[model samples]
Target: MLSATPRTSLGREKHRGSTDRNDLYQVLDTGLVCHLGVVADGHPMVVPTCYGRVGDTLYLHGSTGARSLRAADGAEVCVTVTHLDGLVLARSIFSHSVNYRSAVVYGRARLVTDPDERMDGLRALSEQLVPGQWDYARRPSRKELAATAVLALSLEEASVKIRQGAPEDEDEDYALPVWAGVLPLVTAWGKPEPDPVLPEGIETPVHILRRE
Candidate 1:
């Protein structure tokens, strides 16, 4: 279960809140990018970046020179992932809303230093973005590894909120002639485009072609 921390508590729309830990994992695992919030140079900064999750830990990586990554190391941070499912149309304009699944996590991010763990974290990140590319592509060299920075944040303190189905309209608005329903949104992978300069004999890998 997720910890009931003050930061993770919901002040409104409590009906949409979820305390189940699995819900948090589901939201994070399905998401391809996350917005990381942190205080940098006494100002709030939110950066959109790719991430990976292993067990209860979330790993984020970027260039070592990035200011956001530098500020996040050893500092409290907030990470969020959201998936928009549909647009809910109601009889009244005020009742119009969206269906989405979102998760917010709060924790102190620590910079990974151990060589083996750093490599593992990088692998997790690579796999999260592209399943088979990590093994197929050339591994990072020593100089490349030194130029990258990885931070790990625990998922113990998190909150999840999900909204689905049709929108709710007031009783008086039900009699109105306005149409009401849901427009679902779907995401899919596009066809792979091979590099133009590559040798003609090479072809797209099975893993890339098989992705749905």
Candidate 2:
């Protein structure tokens, strides 16, 4: 069961909320990007960024000089990942909504200082973005590693909300001639475009060529 902290509890649309830890993992695992929210200069700021999850921890990295990462380090931050599945159409305008799976996590991020953990976190990030790339590419050098910063946040406190299937229309409106159904959305990887300066004999790796 997932923990229900004050911030993780859903205030509204409780029916759509999920308490299953697997559901939370599923949402996070499938998402490509997450929005990290932090308080900077007395104002809330949100940044779109790529992330990687390993077990119960989520890792985020950026340049050491980044203001958002610097300000959010060791502070309470909220990370959210959402996937749009479809557009729900109802007879009434107010009843219309989107079918989506979203997860919000609240925790205090700790800047990763250990060299081993930092390298492992970076590997996780690379593998998450592109499977098998971490092994395919060269490792980071000391100078490059010094310029990057990684933050680790626990996934213990999180909220998962999923809206799926068709829209719910009122009984009175069901008799109306208005058409209503869901318009599904799909996401997939496109054809790979090779680098122009690549060696003539070099071929696309299977990990990238088979991406879908």
Candidate 3:
């Protein structure tokens, strides 16, 4: 359940619209890393980490060294995921901006206490990086899960902002003899690197080898 909010400047031009819970989860599922923000000692603490979304929940795994997580328990926190599609190059630097998609979730994060949900959340997190990874990789052991801290946040309160296409330069600037076009950006996976101690007969899985 997402409430109606004022549209962002860029959101009005394209994808900036009311982002319901479903759109946010889809964005979370599409990306691997997210930045979690919280207040620590009255100062903002933002940490970049891996996250995943399942149903109406967003889960982030962090280390004991993380201050944001410690201070964020039962307190309101903001988790965001952003994907930059390209650089909007304008005739003038003043009108230059970026083409990107971003989602921000606001809610109180709680430590996942249920054992079954914790493992299931971790599987969702693993599957985020690679769709079939949860089944392919070894599941977390009891001791390992105990050592990890997973924070869960509801997806009900969130926002999405996006911008697309060319820059908004002055009409007169069109005549200026300068390059005015988008500098494209894209994310891609590299060739698989096998472990030095990997078993001899274990070739890279087709999912990893054929990843785009």
Q: Best candidate, TM-score-wise?
A: 2
Off by over 4 Å in 2: none
Higher-scoring candidate on lDDT, 2 or 3 = 2
Scored by Cα lDDT, where does model 1 land? 0.92
Whose TM-score is higher: candidate 1's or candidate 3's? Answer: 1
Q: Which stretch of 10 consecutive residues in model 3 shows the poorest summed lDDT? A: 5-14
lDDT of 1 by residue, 126-182 (tens): 888888888999999999999999999998889999999988999999999888999
TM-score of each: 0.97, 0.98, 0.89
Clashing pairs in 2: none
- Regarding lDDT, does 1 or 3 come out ahead? 1
lDDT of 2 at 150: 98
Q: How many backbone clashes does candidate 3 have?
A: 1
Runs in model 3 deviating more than 4 A are 5-15, 18-22
| Top lDDT model | 2
- 1 against 2, candidate with superior lDDT: 2
- What TM-score should be assigned to candidate 2? 0.98
lDDT per residue for candidate 2 within 41-153, as digits (tens), equals 99999999989989999999999999999888999999999999999999999889999999999999999999999988898888888989999989899999999999999
